[model samples]
Target: MLTAFLRVFAGEGHPVVLFLDDLQWSDAPTLELLRRLVTTES
Candidate 1:
């Protein structure tokens, strides 16, 4: 599932921005996944 998103957000040449909202209502696993994504370069 994460792999599929990485491919979609590849951005070919431009840039890709990933935005998330309602963090107060988010679960632990969701937050953990977001943390990994934020730390990754590509």
Candidate 2:
């Protein structure tokens, strides 16, 4: 699933912006994915 997301973003030609709301209510898996995305992309 994370690979799929990385591919989607990486394949895009234009800049991307992901808007996530109510992070306090986010579940553990979601937060973990976000962390990985940030670390991997940066």
Report RMSD for candidate 2: 2.8
lDDT of 2 at 33: 86
Q: What is the C-alpha lDDT of each candidate?
A: 0.76, 0.73
Candidate 1 residue-wise lDDT at 30: 92
lDDT of 1 by residue, 1-42 (tens): 694578676766966676778989999999888887777765
Over the stretch 1-42, how does candidate 2's per-residue lDDT look in tens digits? 765656666754754567898999999999988888777742
What global local distance difference test value does model 1 have? 0.76
- Clash list (residue pairs), candidate 1: none
Runs of candidate 1 exceeding 4 Å displacement: 1-4, 11-13
The TM-score that candidate 2 achieves is 0.62
Model 1, 24: alpha-carbon shift in Å? 0.6
RMSD per candidate (Å) reads 2.3, 2.8
For candidate 1, the C-alpha RMSD (Å) to the true structure equals 2.3
